[model samples]
Target: MTTRIDRASAGLPPAAPVRAVHLGLGGFHRSHQAWYTAASPEWGIAAYTFRNTELPRALEQQEGAYTLLVPGAPEATEAIGSISRAHPGADRASWSRDLACPDVAVLTLTVTEAAYAAPERDADSATGRLLAGLRERFRTSGAPIALVPCDNVPDNGAVLRSVLRAATRDDLRFSGWLEEQVSIASTVVDRITPAPTPRDVREVLDTTGLRDEAPVVAEPFSEWLISGDFPAGRPPWELRGARFVDDVGVYQQRKLWFLNGAHTLLAYAGLARGHRTVREAVGDDVLVEMVQAWWQTASRHIPIDAAELAEYRRRLIERFAAPGLRHELAQIAEGGSQKIPARWLPVLRAERAAGRLPEPLVRGLAAWVAHLRVGEVRDPRAAELVGSARAADPVRRTLSALGPDAGADDELVSAVGAELATLAKAGN
Candidate 1:
């Protein structure tokens, strides 16, 4: 029998005080935020999942210690102990209590973009639960706290503030208190952490002689760019390579359009071409050309220097082609309704407004339409998207489903439709 991972068995130090609370605990959070926090042992995270209990339960069994496997020339693994407490979403009492504690200075979120769309009245949603916690904090200590959103949505800080304002509109007292006490911080986080497979667990036992049920496998690359106020104070995340900038908008766009947009394109176009993993798709000459063409159009809109952008793209191609990192196209393809608008449409709109129809972006959109017709779509708006795919005017209806502005673009609609026909003829 392998030795189970616990604080003592892993030779970890005493658990730090829970100075931060994180929602949507998952592989990305573990490999990114929690890993960064581990660099500062004084700041521990009390992590809660949105709905899943198995991850929390598994972490709880191991005293919130897990292995982070970074695969490279010589594979490296570390015991991440930044998460001091792991609680299921059902444990609302602990969540409220933790938030109310004056010592908990920051509340970080990794809930996907879809969670933000949950109805304001739905108290069970991620934002709803946050509102409840804020109310508890207001009623108790009324301490200033930062709300850091680490998702891929554009202007995520302002977006989250908007959602919270709408949720608390009727309650003037709570709303006022919220405005006075809360600071929403936007962040651009990047790390390629694939869902842990059983092989990861087995490898942990084989290499480290410790059985970690919740091991996370990630690429060697990781980045966290933060912009906002932490009135009550926060960890020295800067020591761990986190940059605190005045304007994260440019960086956000660079990430959203360059990194995430490419991923979305590869996910759809790659899958349509019968590729499974990012590595496999990026290796194909056809898919690589598609990606390069899309990058060319997207680069025109980004304000960054040309050399830097080229270097970024070069590094991205290397990262995408990282061997043994099974970043699945199907996994990246989830929630296209939320992702496409954020990732591709901005470039499409800008290119169209410039009197140039971007063929690569149009092809990417067409690939999405084709995928919706036959791929395994796991989106919050799946029914509507799949329905739109089957419509007589599929491209028009699909664009409409994405957003009103996209649907109204006559030139874009024609281009995407034409590309879809070509894709169908080519069996893509």
Candidate 2:
């Protein structure tokens, strides 16, 4: 007998005019960008999913209003109304139309890192889709726009620009327009949003007297550091704890090597230890020690002050152990092939070049090998990774799969092999 969440039921104001477009409309987008934009009532988002229509359909049914549950001693739940429209990825007409609109000042993306690797002409890829939208924008209004990539790739803004430039190299006029009219912004976004459980739905129904099919549950913590220009205009995201920095690289390095690196370790190591959620994994003393050790190795590379790094680590541990945030290891473990190179290899190579063997980093690599051996994790390169894991020289072959010259380092191979032996002996 609960009401469905909509503008009226949630007592929300009328939907704001759509001034932004978001691709990869998922849980993280709900908890992060959309939430930040909620503080700027004048700017609304036209959100589109990558592939699935289920979420978009459900959200559209609810009039793009959904509950955001922040679990704590006193849980906070609010109906988010920043999404003015929700459409499936197949709605290319709407996507192109929206991007072509002169009023749409910014476009944000949460598509995974893998999406960036797709050929720019591959219509199914995120970059391909973006290229198409930009073509539409260029042909129609030729209005300036900001492209903000919210994924975890390093120097995401530059990466996007590079890919788009390569894509449009054949068309000099369009290329010139791209360079002139588009501003690509790099960003560091943080929020731990777990997939909503049925229990969460029931809780939303009980507490708010509304059924929210698209509710997102997240930790109270959130951060967004952006670097670039918005020529057309943008929401005052800074007012909602987002920082506009001159350079996002340092902050990006801190987040990538610290928080995401630890999560990668926890994903592979914790899952091997039979822990499911991050909360469960972080509670284990063994996993906690491993995370601390990994953080120590990664911290050496980040340019942040030691005191601030220590505090960030402390806060990270607390966030990982936050109650009711059932952040799944399986979810994090899905893209090890893409993640390890970004999160671990930088620290590993740096430490190695310094004449130091990073044991914790190596151990995390071993855990990834072990996870691959089990053949449970989902990865775009799963078949190849599994083949390498089960190959004649698994340690070397697996390392080779991760990076071009990784296995060529005999010392690294020997160390990883030894660690793999230890894991096998422990039956992990």
Task: Using TM-score, give the best candidate's number.
Answer: 2
Ten-residue stretch with the least lDDT total in model 2: 69-78
1-428 per-residue lDDT for model 2 (tens digits): 66789998999888899999999999999999999999988998999998889999999999899999886523578999999999999999999999999999999999887898655558789999998899999999999999999989999999999999888898999999999989999999999988999988887887788989999999999999999999999999988899998999988888888889899899998987889999999999999998898888887787789999999999999999988788999999898989888888888899889999888878888999999998486998898989889889999998998886788988999998999899899983
Global lDDT of each model?
0.90, 0.90
Report model 2's TM-score to 2 decimal places: 0.98
- Candidate 2: how large is its RMSD? 1.2
User: lDDT tens string, model 1, 158-226?
Assistant: 999999988888999999988988999989999998887777777777778999989999998889999
- Per-model root-mean-square deviation over C-alphas: 1.4, 1.2
Candidate 2 clashes: the total is: 0
Off by over 4 Å in 2: 73-75
Q: After superposition, how far is residue 22 of candidate 2 from its true place, in Å?
A: 0.5
Candidate 1 residues lying further than 4 Å off, grouped into runs, are: 73-75
TM-score of candidate 1 versus the correct structure, residues matched by position? 0.97
